[model samples]
Target chain A: MFLPGRRLSLVLGTALAVGAFAWFFASGERNIPDTEGGLDGNGQAGVFAAAAGAALVSGLVLSSLTNALRLPGKPLEIGLDGLNGATYLQALSGLVAEVSRSWRRQIQQYFSG
Target chain B: MAVLVSDYFIPAIFALVLFSLWFAGRDRVEREAHQRAVGISMTALGIANLAVQVINSVYFRPRPFVQYELDLLFYRPTDSSFPANPAALTFAIATGVWGGNRRVGAALYALAVLYGLSRVYAGVFYPSDILAGAAIGVVVALLVSKLFLLLEPLPTIVLRLARRLYLA
Candidate 1:
């Protein structure tokens, strides 16, 4: 079984996404909003939302194809599920549960004592 | 932003994507099963986000601070900020992590805050939009994550189909 802290791929993913976003800004490429919008066909919100939607669709389609090819094999698949990612929610949940457990134990001890 | 440093769109989206990646990356289950779970969960989130976007296009709304010239950290998009689809997508990814992967959820939550604050700062999106989007995303993620687990029997059926089709 892979150790929780041993996972580095998730950290990489977080870094990549953040780096990409920052790069977009730091690159300083002036985004001249194309007046002639394509899919959105209206304003800034439409365009941004459309872009986000496109990203989602494209990512899904690509992921399916990757799966068919077994690109990541089993390890990669786990990573994609969002469960394998080395995030802090697990620790927090553990901490919360631990606190509750400890609190309960304390109360039980008090009553027993 | 009128909200805070954490209330931005870019940071939120970034957090979402990263959290999803991180959560899905930490499976203790069999590799193939884990992979399939991640793939399905991500695809669901992606589709939900996309579908919501299309709906938004048809149902256009306005931004919160569009009327006033405000100093901000990011560029604002012109669209109805209600039902923040991006936030919803992130939340879905976060819930999918659940007990199976906590790191991913934390990352996603962090990203949610960033995305929400960024939108407000950019002078696009109302608090309502961010709230709705985040709530929806969380609900969807929870539902879809369980759905993936339920589909455990699918791989066998799919394999049988592949054999019949001679694609195996």
Candidate 2:
């Protein structure tokens, strides 16, 4: 059932990862911005921001592929139960739950008072 | 601000990485798998960071402090600023964990951004340098995650040796 999804993820992830790497190395050789004389203020920011965006997109796409490939042939469960590690999801959810529980207690106390 | 940027920021980032490791350790059921994944991710990150160094050597660029006199926090480095090393390392780790857990990945990604911005704010790196570094880190991580299965034999051998020594 999930084979098609896995295959699609594998294909898309590989393509994005390869394409991003190629683009970066191919165009990364330009001379550093001549900001010595303060000629192009923020040029560095602009360039780096664009690069960061590209990197982020590539990373997310590739990560999705990894997840898709890893999670097949198993029951779908959220959090870090996939591999048995304390996943980021687990930590974050725990923190959120704790906070929310505390908040709820506080609200109840206030209303009861 | 200077103290935070110079003295505390790097340590804070390190702490974040440690925290992730500690989090992985807390899981009794998937502990082994999580640790293995972390190991794989970190090894990949090291390789990617080394590649960045090679790239830096080929295309040298001065640090922002070397280029301009800004509010300096730490002693200036003589390394190339084309790709920010800190950004690369942090992003690589983030991307590594991201494959296993999205929420954790997102948190690490946020931390990576903060670290990059702090480097820029400290006038140590240019914005583009951080971006480029992050991009490289991401690419390396993705490749590693995708090809991890192919590299399984290497770890399996290490595990066998460790088991022999009763160290695994």
Candidate 3:
């Protein structure tokens, strides 16, 4: 049972961890004497894996800490949007049509001017 | 600044921004929309990578640092420099988010441009490569977003399942 606020914190932590590792790998830890320190194929993969692990650990720690803090009221649940299959299809179709209409209008305006 | 940005800072920001959006929004509706953008961006990124690979296999261009002696800010890469991979990837993400949220999308676009310029400044890629990469990314993202829209109910179904597991 993950609280909404904790879940948010977890994601934020993961993002930060991943970003920090990427920067560190590409910039801070880049000066190797023998090699020019460019990211080769293997190096890139290692960086990604390491960053992911770091993100997971950091996210978990942040979420656990947030849970321990136990902020005042219960957070709101992130419920479903209630858009079923049919409604979902309808919404997409409407969006496409709207985009098309807008494009047409823009084209007309361009030609008119 | 150019070295830091060209090396990894901007790309990292892209990931961070996308991750933040994935879990953002007040209600399920908004959150779902944001997630959809992130999904689209990820798919576009995959496609962009494939495109870059295909192009690299077909056409090989030397890196700017390799072609001429210049003050190189970053390390030398062995990969072909025809279509800048970072540029394509960042632009793909920007375009993907643009379809869902214009403001964020525009901001991403700006960052993408900056990333391309930074790469050029670092002597990793040519202007032509960056332009080509940006074009490929934008086109791929637009096409993927349209395709996702066409495949409507399928995405919604997947999202619902993820939501059930609290993974969405």
Candidate 4:
């Protein structure tokens, strides 16, 4: 028996640790340069910083708006269960009919206009 | 350690995406939705990365290794350093998943942060670069996820195909 939850948690924990260690040590490196002029010596760090901040703020706002609206969630089920040739053909035909109906409606609207 | 953080971490980030996909696949009910979310998120990430590239072209930032003599663990890139590409992609994927699954999303976000910080540690990118990348990624993910909901038929078609192929 394999425990996916436990394994995933372990992996996530390790990744976080590695990332933390890197950030901590990287900050202390002597070769690192001053942030006064930005990384490229072109003073673009300010611009990048502003853009990054804007993006974060916008993302948060959008996420909250969507959540508050109580948007319907989609299903994410994926597996190879209950599929056979008959069902495949049935689905295919249904799809074709749906496409044909949509096209016919568009054509009718175009000609009537 | 520097080499591991800078060079090896790249593959690890990719592995994280794969793991995320697999984890989503395990969801018997929401697998298709999760897959759709992943697709939309990746598409958004791709577009954002292209946008970042355009920005980088306008503003060229030199890598830390290029400015100072440091023991670089990886090959020095001649690209713009203001917005890190890897950080952008990882964060985009993480944020996209987060919209669908909170637990996994949180984990992925943590990984994205780690990846961003590691790039700085590796001396290939500046902290600002990582920050910009992450911001772009998150915004794109949020916007794309919302936009994708309007195109519900697209995912329905994909789900139908997956079902036909016995892939649920």
Runs with alpha carbons beyond 4 Å of true place in candidate 4: A1-79, A83-113, B2-16, B19-27
The local lDDT score (0 to 100) that residue A47 gets in candidate 2 is 48
TM-score of chain A, model number 3: 0.35
Q: Evaluate residue B134 in candidate 4 and report its C-alpha lDDT on the 0 to 100 scale.
A: 89
**What ranking of all candidate models by lDDT puts the best one first?**
3, 4, 2, 1
DockQ ranking, high to low: 4, 3, 1, 2
Error of 2 at A48 (Å): 30
Worst 10 residues of 2 chain B by lDDT: B159-168
- Candidate 3 to truth, TM: 0.70
Candidate with top DockQ is 4
Expressed as tens digits, the lDDT of each residue in A1-113 for candidate 1 is: 12235347457655767796677555654343343332221243344556665765564455444443333222222122432332223323444576799999999999999
- Candidate 2 residue lDDT tens string, B91-147: 887888777666767888887888788878878889999999999888888888767
Tell me the whole-model lDDT of each prediction, alpha carbons only.
0.52, 0.61, 0.73, 0.62
Query: lDDT tens string, model 1, B47-103?
Result: 668767876888877666676677655445665666776567656655654434466
DockQ of each: 0.03, 0.02, 0.06, 0.11
Candidate 4 residue lDDT tens string, A1-113: 01125577568756765786478456754222334321431223244346545744463355434443242322122233332112323333455676799999999999999
TM-scores for chain B, listed for all candidates: 0.65, 0.79, 0.94, 0.85
Report the candidate with higher TM-score, 1 versus 3. 3
In model 2, which residue pairs have backbone atoms overlapping below 3 Å? A48-B128, A84-B30
Itemize residue pairs with steric clashes in candidate 3.
Answer: none
Tens digit per residue, CA lDDT, model 3, B1-168: 643554556766777788678767777778888989988998998899899999999999989888799897766677899898888888999999987778899999998998888888878899999999999999999999999989999889988876643346
- The reply for model 1, stretches above 4 Å from the true place, is A1-25, A30-113, B1-37, B54-58, B155-168
